[model samples]
Target: MNPLISNALKKDLELYFSEDDLSRNLYYTASLPHDLVDCKLKLKDDLLLAGLPYFVEAFRYLGDTSLDWDYFKKFEGKTYKKDEKAEIHFQLPFAIALTGERIALNLLQHASSIATYTSKFAARAKDKGIAILDTRKTTPGHRSLEKYAVRVGGGYNHRLGQTDLWMIKDNHKSFFGGVKEAVEFFRSMKGFYTPIEVEVHNMSELEEVLSLGIRHIMLDNFSPEEVKRAVKLKPVGVSFEVSGGIRLSNLDDYLIKGLDAISVGALTNGAPNVDISLKYNR
Candidate 1:
């Protein structure tokens, strides 16, 4: 399993079981005639399936050691229509399935939702040779899973975490006196070769950073017309991205030529979970 997935799952399990008290389930454990049962994982809505690994891992983590791993692996990243009634059948201990259902579905639904939402933007961006990117505005502990879902939906990730790239945003520029100072400070550091990206809020800021020789730039909240102008000013090999106030509705307005990518925070933050559920097969 991916270490990030494992770590997040561990934290989720600890938080959930800590509050719910697993022993309560054990109260009826002895009365149940069967320890293991067949089950169906059903989709209640159309969705691009993601995080099957996490869902399966959740059951394994909860001691469902005999799960049908091969059966689940085939469905990852598959898109299913609501009317099709996508159903995944497997068998696991009844108590373990019940205990891990929500955790499993939570991770699955959240990831699938992000993937589904991102696909819309990605499909639109792809037509213009532009890439759709996801922002750092993800659930605190679920960054890894969320970013994974973004990729599954055809979107690229900007920076997995702060250290992945050196980004000088408005706040960083304000504290460091200006964009030049902030850019130079990082540039001056010995062996700090992480690619630098600066968020420029206006044309002036754009020109200043352009002179600083920053290769990657994000035009913060720039309109389509403004982005077209910024693109004209962009030197050869410099990449321009747009962020802020971007959504599916207004996405086309910003798909101007020369724009390298569009980063949408709503991919993870605003996406509603795709409906899914797990139930006994009876």
Candidate 2:
């Protein structure tokens, strides 16, 4: 289990239950045998599944959540029929059955939904070197987990956080007086090793970054034609990324424009939960 996830889940559970006395009441009634037990998960729609570990991890840590996963019953990046059942065997005290079930399914459905949406966009933009990138615009505490699903569904990730890489956006440029000064400041930092990405809205700024020889650039809010032109004008060896208002519907315009990658906020923010359910198989 990733330490980040372990820490986040611990924090989340602690935060949610700080004032609640329900944990004791809920645990007693939901406990199951700490020996082998059978449970199954079902989905109501076809989806690209991801984040199985987080689902399992959440349960394992949640007093009743860990179970012996039945590998043969799993979906391996394949589509599933609606109402299909997937099984796992685990031992838990019956006292916390409901608690474990709810947490596991919630994580599974939410993560899978993001993966489903990402897969759809990635498939549509296959080829043209146009990788689908998930932005840091993710659920605040669930960044790593959500980004993991994006990767599982054939998409790539942008910077993980402010510390992961240097992403100088328009606001930073304005706050620091101008783009040139920001570029020079970053360039001057001793022992700096991270790749720098600057966001530009127009051709003039793009030209300015080109002079700075920054290798990664974001073309924010550019029209399809402008993106194409920017792609042409990009300094040789520099990669171009597109963001702001990108959607599955208008993807083809940018896809055909031959941008290196497109980052969509919807991959995490507005993704609808893929319908899933739990059914007891007798």
Candidate 3:
């Protein structure tokens, strides 16, 4: 498992199984007649696949140590159909399987859904060199996994967190009096390595930020005409990203030239859970 994934799952194990269940599950498994069991996972709907990392970790944490991580990883990043056996003929102790079932399914469905949705938008921008970006509006405690799924679906990540990229958003502008002040304050700070990307709503603010040598600007909620105007006025080498209300449905309308990226919060926030289920063979 990736170290980051391993660390995130550390909390998951504790969250999914209570201390009593954690202690008792071992005892429960010990009492079972069968030492090993067979299980398979079947998806009820077609979806782009993701989240095999969590599944392997779940089994590993629950006492199945013989898993070949590389071999099992083949199922991830691949699409599957309804009624497809995603995990076929895998054996683990029955108690362990029972304990990890829901967590594994949750991870798989949640990630695959985001991946599936991301692909929809990514495909819209395939030839344009436009990168599909996910916003910070991810579920708590699963940002890395969610972001990873976005990449799996052929989209790119914006930033891991606030620490990596300095974004002067609306609230920051409000707190610091205005966009100019916010940008000035960020520029005045020393040792900031990453370039600042400020949110601009109109032509004047976009022009001002451009003058400030801000290389990346997010055109929040701009219509296609406004986006075209901004692109025409934008400096060469500076990238413009669009956000707010941008979905796969309305995406083509905004694919103006010189538009570099689009950050969709719905990639993680509004994504539907893809249908995937696990059943142990009787």
Mind giving the per-residue lDDT tens digits that candidate 1 earns over 1-282? 555655666766566456566677676755544467888889989889998878888877876667665677789888899999989888877767777788888889999999999998998989899999999998877887899999999999999988788889988888999999999877776536789999999999999999988999999999888998999998999999999999999999998989999999999999877899888844
Residue-level lDDT of model 3, residues 158-275, one tens digit each, is 9999867889988988999988899888887763686789998888889888888889999999999999988988787899999999887799998778999999999999887887
| Candidate 1 residue runs with Cα over 4 Å from true position | 1-34
Could you tell me the lDDT of residue 130 within candidate 2? Answer: 90
Error of 1 at 22 (Å): 2.5
Q: Estimate each model's TM-score.
A: 0.91, 0.85, 0.91
Worst 10 residues of 2 by lDDT: 64-73
For model 1 the local lDDT of residue 199 reads: 96
Cα lDDT listed for each candidate: 0.86, 0.74, 0.83
Q: Give the TM-score of candidate 3.
A: 0.91
- Deviation of model 2 at 43, angstroms: 1.2
Runs with alpha carbons beyond 4 Å of true place in candidate 3: 1-8, 16-34, 83-87
Provide the lDDT at 204 for model 2. 96
lDDT per residue as tens, model 2, 80-155: 6565654434444443444556666766787888888898899988866799999988887678668888887889
